[model samples]
Target: MASVLWFRRDLRINDNPLLSEFRQDIVLPVFIFDTQILNKLSKDDKRVSFIFYSVMKLKNDLKAIGLDLAIFYGEPLEVFEKISSICHIDEILACGDNDFYAKSRDEKISQSYKLISFNDAFLLPASYGLKKDGTPYRVFTPFYKSVLPFVEILSQNQYKIKSAKLVDFDYKSIQLESFGFEKADISHIPYIDKPMELLNDFKPYFDMYKDLRDDISKKPYTSGLGIHLRFGTIGIRECIRELILYQKEGIDTSEFIRELIWREFWNMLLIHFPKSEFDNFYAVDIKWENDKDKFHSWCEGKTGVPIIDAAMRELNATGFMHNRLRMIVSSFLTKDLLIDWRWGERYFAMKLLDYEASSNIGSWQWASSTGADGVPYFRVFNPYLQTKKFDKDGVYIKRWVSEYKDIPSGKLYDENYLLMYGDSFYKKPIVVHKVASERFVRAYKDGMIK
Candidate 1:
């Protein structure tokens, strides 16, 4: 009987536990273009394009080993049923996904097949990293401290491919049009062929990451590997192993590793409190203004605040935003605009190429001050001050907001100077920062009291 390797988030050939499990057996590797998820996306979603490219790459690699990837476009259950009808599948092996939809889908699939899943997405399995009472940790500091000591780095597996009984079915790649999506122009997007190449490129900047990560002007200061991690093109353990190697070479990896741990923190939170995906973890009974016009302005990068506008424009054009800007823009949306964080979260879910549900929701809740360990409600990010501090020379602002290219750096942060540009040059600031901050603080305090 042949085994079925069901590829979900884990797309790469190396560091794949599911692929390693059936190294010597007849493994039918399959990737389903899930309609349940795809139906919600636009026709030109870059994330879909990236995924399609990755699956094609995986198919080519399998062909080199005298194997073929079985690609399908439909619901997971229906796709699996078709696979079962075609061959005598012994069991289904896959890397487990912890999102709400995945959990539900896997539960239904398990009822029909012997689905064996592994924790390939995170460094620590969902079961590990717990509190003293065997419950999940809501706070991140304690969770990180507790799990740090128990972290074990695994060596990369080298699988021995063996010929086995081949199924008599056509194994070919599926067309994007067949799944109701068109070819997205992703030429501007940076994609790595191998995970090791990405790690190698980041080596030169690894030491300075702690110092320059917060500087928005230095655009690529942080390792640009979020999409790879989100899609599991690179395994978390493999990344940790490289970090360990870097530490041995006398470079401090604590800050970079902490960022990785933050990803795990979100994963743990989502696994324990799945409701946090859609609802506020710590519910506050405050009425959101939900200004439709304000949201449209923010989405269109017409917030009038240079930094916020730059960040939003960057996200709109590239499907990627700088981390510091993400925090600032999110703060501006929830604090200044007084819009519900869910609206901003939903927009990001649709736009971000590297959007992971757990991290995106976690970050939104944190920015909105509604999560278990979120920032204080009154702590609003002042967009002007943030620009002066991070993008002092206005390089990032000029790069994204072309209208402000000729403006002097000093004048960019000055409201009076910006007034000279008038509405034609840029839209006036939607809400006065100080006034909005006071309003939000007062409302938040009253809600907490109630």
Candidate 2:
């Protein structure tokens, strides 16, 4: 039986159910850098580069064991047609994907091939638990608690594929450069990749993740493995094992582990409520300002707000931002700028190397107060107050917005931040917090209160 192991978001070879099971059969490891998706991406996209790099590593590892990767680069359906004509591909196995495009794509392929998907991307199985009435849980905490006992946290060393026996294929891969991937300057950006043996370097910091995860200035203390998780360079199961192992050692790492559960919970929501990708999940009547000029400034980090702009610059520059700041910037964009959450959400979806539609969309809606268990419209974040509370020393602010070193003489722009984000250096904020807050309060009250 010739089974094809179709690699999608789950890119690694270790503890990968599909990849591991394939070694025991006459399997052909295949990765289709589906042009349908890639054609939509920018040339210097790190996510595509990361995917190319990881799959190359997989191909090379397989080659070391006399096996090779059969990469396809067209529409998945057409590629399937070509593969199906040459040899009988009895089964196709892939890690489950919960994104809108992925689900529809999988369905298209599944109609043509006998396919099976495993939970390699998410810790919890995509299956939902129901009440006696058999309905999906609406709230995150209860759904999270209900699924806690069923998690299977597998260790990195659990899988031992002795060899990758060659399954010859008459196929070719488009070189990464030809696909428009170039060398990236990763000097300033913080990334944690296990394939490069980054785990030992960060082991000392994992225990402190609980205390420092939300600290705006010290994001390195939290495992910056979002990219790894996004690309499957680090498996969800492997991360869980590390979490559980540390807990047994009496390390209080619940906060970081809880974040992983959040990722899974969002994935669950994506599968059940795919419409959240574009439309509002709860408040359907809400409207967003679609000002291109305001959005451009926000994207370019000229929002006049120090912390929000700093976070935006960081995301624009490094493809990452601290979690604390992500929420602040998200909220500021939605309420303060009165911009559509989908607009900010789509930009994040494009720039974040760690971008997952499920998490990205879920978080944007959560911050906008249009989704489940989010901040009520009345509870808006004041960026100035938030900076004073979380980044008291101005460490993070200084690092990103280097223009603001000294407060301006006399209170010309902002007496508090005349130097760093002075009126001259940054654009004046599109909307004032007090007015915007009142506007949101009234709008939400009028729409949802009654």
Candidate 3:
């Protein structure tokens, strides 16, 4: 009997549960560039380049073990059907994705083959955590406290690759041009070829993460593991293992562990409440203004507010933005501009290199105050105050928004001051922050579900 090992988002060979799970005499390891997803992305999408790079690496890694990775381009079902005609398929082993498109694709594939999915992308599956009432935990603190033991246990867990004879099918070669995609310039992105280097480099400063993480000027204070984790280039378990090792070495890793668990929290919540992907988790009807012109300004980094413009510009240029900046800009878009969080979420999905659907959706909802464990609507972030606290010297601001380099750091924080003394190239603030925030809070109070 032959088993097909399908590599989807879990692109790594190390600590891969699929490699260890297959017990069939013959194993066909394959990767399909699903046209369904690629059709929606732009031709110059950086993520496609990154995935292509990782898949080639996986192919080489598998070949080192006397196995080859078969490459195909088509719809998944059609690709699998072609595979079945060649090999007597017993089961398809893969790491499952919980997103809407993935769940539907997996369900459809299960009708024809025994599709066995393993939770290798995340530390634990959605079913691992529950309150006393047997429902999922909505709040992060309670969920973290409840699942801490499982994370500890799972961190130490390791996997060994089992052997299987390679199915001698014609291993096809695929290139970026074959998929009609041009190579994206990912020169600015660090650790593309090796994600572990970033983690190892961050180890010495793990203790300072909690204190300096929010400061935008301290760029290296944050770990750039998001894209690696997003692609499963580095397994979640391996990350936690490293974290545990650091803790044993007398370094405080509690803050870093908490951030990792936040990623898990978003993943679990998405699985439990799938509708939260497109709808508000809480039953609140928000009357969003959703001005396209204003959204365009925000997208183009013409928002007049220094912090918001700087963050948006950074994301546009490099496909990355600091975590603190993400929260600030998201809140500004949803609350101050009164745009729908969905609009902001979709925009981020289009632009962010490290975009995870669960985290993006959950975070956008949280910023808009329309999600479980969401910030209260009344707590709107003042962009000026945020700039003062996080980018006090305007170093980060000046790095992204060149027009603001001549303006005083203190003037960048004040909207009125910028209008008075800033460069002519800078646009006027879209709306009065105090007025817009108060309006949103009142509107939220009025429209909330009783």
Candidate 4:
């Protein structure tokens, strides 16, 4: 039977269920640059360039194995239909995607062809962990505990690719520009081609991760694996294996693994509650100020709060923000600026090279106190205090906000001082932290009452 190996998020050849489990007589490996999604993205989107690079690398790797990856530029349905017209396709195998657009697209394609999907993107399927009554767990800790046992079982790699004849097809090479995206400068980004290298680089710092993971100033702070994991350049099982290996070496990896489980929790939450992408999960009726100028300032990293400015500038420049910085900036946007979390979430979607819909949406909701197991509305992060805590030496701030280099680090932590200094070099604080925090909490309480 002729089967098409449709590559989506899972871009790698190693540890891929789609490649290892296939037993068809004839197989066509394919990757599509979905124009439907691409059209909505900016021409200079860093993710497009990264994906293009990864896809090309995958193509070459497949060719080395006496197989070729066919590249297509169109919607999945139309592309599949085109492939179906040429050959008698028995089935198309791909890694399952739980995002709304992916689900809808796959459903449409399944109507016309036999489409089979595997859970290669994540360690476990979204439906794995549930409460006693069969309802999905809303809280994370219980969910993490429930799924923790299965890590061993899931980690066990057991698969071999059966010999299959490569389907002969006229494949075409496509450039990043052909898809209407400018070639992005991805050299500064880590592990675009080699995920294992990044993993190796992260090992030395893994010991300090428990204590310093939240410190934005610590270079190589968190495992720089988010982008690799997001695109399936590295498999979740492979990462789990590394963690387990560390655990066997008597290195405490539980805290790091917990963060991975949090990623899982967010994915599961998104699968069950897709509407939370746009609406509040808990239905808090927050009447967001959504000041256009304030949001623009926040996006441009001109929030007058040193930490917020630094983090925002980092994200805008590099398509990456530290986890702690994400939390701080998100709080500043949602609570401090009284802007809609959706606004900030959407902006991240546009910029972050590691942007995963589930994680991004889940995190934004959490920051805004509109999600299950989210931070309380009363717990607004004081940007100044956060700076004093995470970036005490002002290393991160100085690195990103170059204008603040000559200024004393202490002044950055003082909102009144920055405000008094005025708009000479940097922007003044758009909203006072004390006043904004109280107003936000009051608004949230009012939302609950209504």
Candidate 5:
């Protein structure tokens, strides 16, 4: 009896524990184009295109090794049923996904088949990172400290993949058009076949990450490993290994490693409190003044706040946004516009090519001050101050917001100067910063009293 290697988020074969375990067996690799998730996405969704590209790449890699990847487009359960009918599958091996939907899906799958799943995406498993009292951590610092030792030990446990015996099966891939998604233009998307090359390229910048990461106007000072990490193209263990090597070179890798810990921290929170994905983690009443018009403006990058607009436009165009800009734009939506963080989170889920549920939701909540260890509710990011600090030269703003290309750097921070450009050329600021800041604080305070 042969085992089926079910690939979900963990797409790559390198450092994949699930794939490594079934190397000696007649393993048939499989990926289900989950329609339940796909139905919600746009036809030109870059994320869907990226996933399709990754799946295709995985298929070719497996084909070269005399194995075949069975690609199916349907509900995962139905797809598994079809797979069972085609092959005499004894067991299904897959990496455990920590999100609520994934957990529910995996539970149903386990009921039907001999499912052997491992938490291959995160450095430390969800269960291993809890407090001494066995309660889940609400804050990041303690959580990071608690998991550090385990992370160091497990970071060394990298998976070695041996050749698998190819099973005789008619393997086929469902066309992108079959699922109502257009054929992906992989030109703009950074889909790396060998993640190691990307990691190596990022090494030189790792030391400067802490200093220049927040500088939005500059070229990417941080590692652009998010998309690769999201799909498990590169395993977390391998990333940690790279960090270890960097540390040995006397590089201050603490800042970069902290980011990886943050990713794991969010994953742990999702595993422990699944409701945090949709609802506020802490029980607090919120009166969301969700203005549809303002929300649309924010989405289209027409809010007239150069930094906010730039970030939004970048996300709309590339399906990716810088980390600092993500916080800025998110804060603008939730705090400045007084919109619900869920609104921003939903939009990110729709657009971000590197969208991971836990990270997206967690980060949105952090910016909106609704999550555990979130920024204080009173602390709203002033777009003018942020622009002056991060994009002092308006280079980032000029790149995304075309109308602001020739605007003076000093004038970019002036609301009145930006307004002079007019609604015809550049949009006027939707809300006065001073007024909105006061209104948001008052509203939050009133909600707390009620």
Candidate 6:
């Protein structure tokens, strides 16, 4: 009998629980570029290209053994329909994903096939985070505390690191280009470089991640392993294992470890409250001040506030922004522009290289003061003030918004638009931040009272 190893988000070979225990005679490993997902990605999505490249990396790593990865491009159920029709299969083992699309797809797959899934996406197992009450934890810190012991236990003997062996598989007929996606050129974007380096060997920065993490300009200093986590290029368990090893060596990697815990918090949130994928967690009687024209301006990074514009433009151009900038820009959208969190969420969904539904929705809802277990509604962040604090020199802003020449001239705080090679084309801030803050605050306070 053959056990099919269905690859969804977990794309790597290290520390995968589902693959580790599959002691079957014939094991078939298959990856599907499910159209349910691919159809939604843009034609030139670098994230898709990254995933394809990572999949190829996995296949090459497996090819070191005498096996080839079977890849398919179609609706997942359809892909399975064809696969099960031709290949003799007994049971399907996979590392289940916490995202909406992945869960729905897995449910459909399970209905049609014999499926047993495991949690390889987190340091703490997803099941361990629940209370005696049988509900998932909404607050992050308590959840973190609850799951700490499981993380400790799993850290020991996680991956026994056997030879890079693939459980022999026959590939199915498939072509990625047949679907509407392009090969990665990876030309101008420097962020896409050296992913394996960032994954396997980067350790120094994670030790300092606590102090250096929030700095917008020092972002590349933080090991840039987020895309790795998002795509599962480096297994979550591997990251935690390394973190524990660092701790044993008397290094304080708690901050980096906390970020991983946060990652688990997000996925757990998605699992317990799937409805949060599109809807707000708490009631906000106040209506969103959603202005399309303003949102468009914001999208173009012309919102007139330099930092917000810079952050938005950075995201639009490169599909990434510093985590601090992510919060600042999101706050500007939901609070200052009075746009719905959903609007900003969809925009990030389109643009971010590391976009995950749980984090995106959780962050946006937190900014909008409509999510449980996040920033209080009254705590609105001011982008101009935040820029002055985190990016005092405005170096990050200048990188994306070249028109802010005054900052380069060392007179930006004086407040007149410094000519971008001599023209004032940089957009103006859309609404007065203070005015918007008061509006959002009063409305939210009133909503809470009501």
lDDT (Cα atoms) of all candidates against the true structure: 0.83, 0.74, 0.89, 0.87, 0.83, 0.73
TM-score of candidate 6 on Cα atoms, chains taken together:
0.90
Cα RMSDs, all models: 2.1, 3.1, 1.2, 1.3, 1.9, 3.2
Clashing pairs in 5: none
Best by TM-score: 3
Better of 4 and 5 by TM-score: 4
Model 1 spans > 4 angstroms off? 22-24, 154-165, 419-421
Model 2 residue 231 distance off true place after TM-score fit, in angstroms: 1.4
User: In model 5, which runs have C-alpha deviations exceeding 4 angstroms?
Assistant: 419-425
- lDDT ranking, best first: 3, 4, 5, 1, 2, 6
- Once fitted onto the true fold, the runs of candidate 6 whose alpha carbons sit more than 4 angstroms away are 132-135, 157-175, 187-196, 199-201, 407-425
Positional deviation of residue 346's Cα in model 3 after best superposition, in angstroms: 0.8
Give the residue spans of candidate 3 off by over 4 A. Answer: 421-425
lDDT of 4 by residue, 364-412 (tens): 9999999889866799999999999988889989999998998888888
Task: List the candidate 2 regions with Cα displacement exceeding 4 Å.
Answer: 22-24, 152-165, 171-173, 186-193, 196-200, 408-421
Predicted candidate 5 versus true structure: per-residue lDDT over 94-197, tens digit per residue: 98887778889889988998889887888887777588899999999999887877777899897787677866776866788887889756576553666667
User: What's model 5's TM-score?
Assistant: 0.95
Q: Write the per-residue lDDT of candidate 2 for residues 1-450, one digit (tens) a residue.
A: 577888887777777787566534677789998888988888787777777777887877667666678987789889888887877788888887887788899999899888888777777655654445667666788987877666643334354454444456775666877656675654443443344344445666667777666787655566667877887877777777766766787766566777887887787777778788878888556656677888888898887777777889989888988788889988888887778899989899889888988888889989988886687678998887787777777777778887655533222234244443456665556667778877876666666733
- In model 1, state the lDDT of residue 379: 86
- Superposed model 4: Cα runs more than 4 Å off: none
Q: Give per-candidate clash totals.
A: 0, 2, 0, 0, 0, 4
Instruction: Find the 10 residues in a row with the least total lDDT in model 1.
Output: 152-161
RMSD of 6: 3.2
Candidate 3 lDDT by residue in tens digits, 158-208:
777888899989987788898799999987777888877777888878999
Name the weakest run of 10 consecutive residues (lDDT summed) in model 5.
184-193
lDDT of 4: 0.87
Give each model a TM-score: 0.95, 0.90, 0.98, 0.97, 0.95, 0.90
Clash count, predicted structure 4? 0
Error of 2 at 387 (Å): 0.5
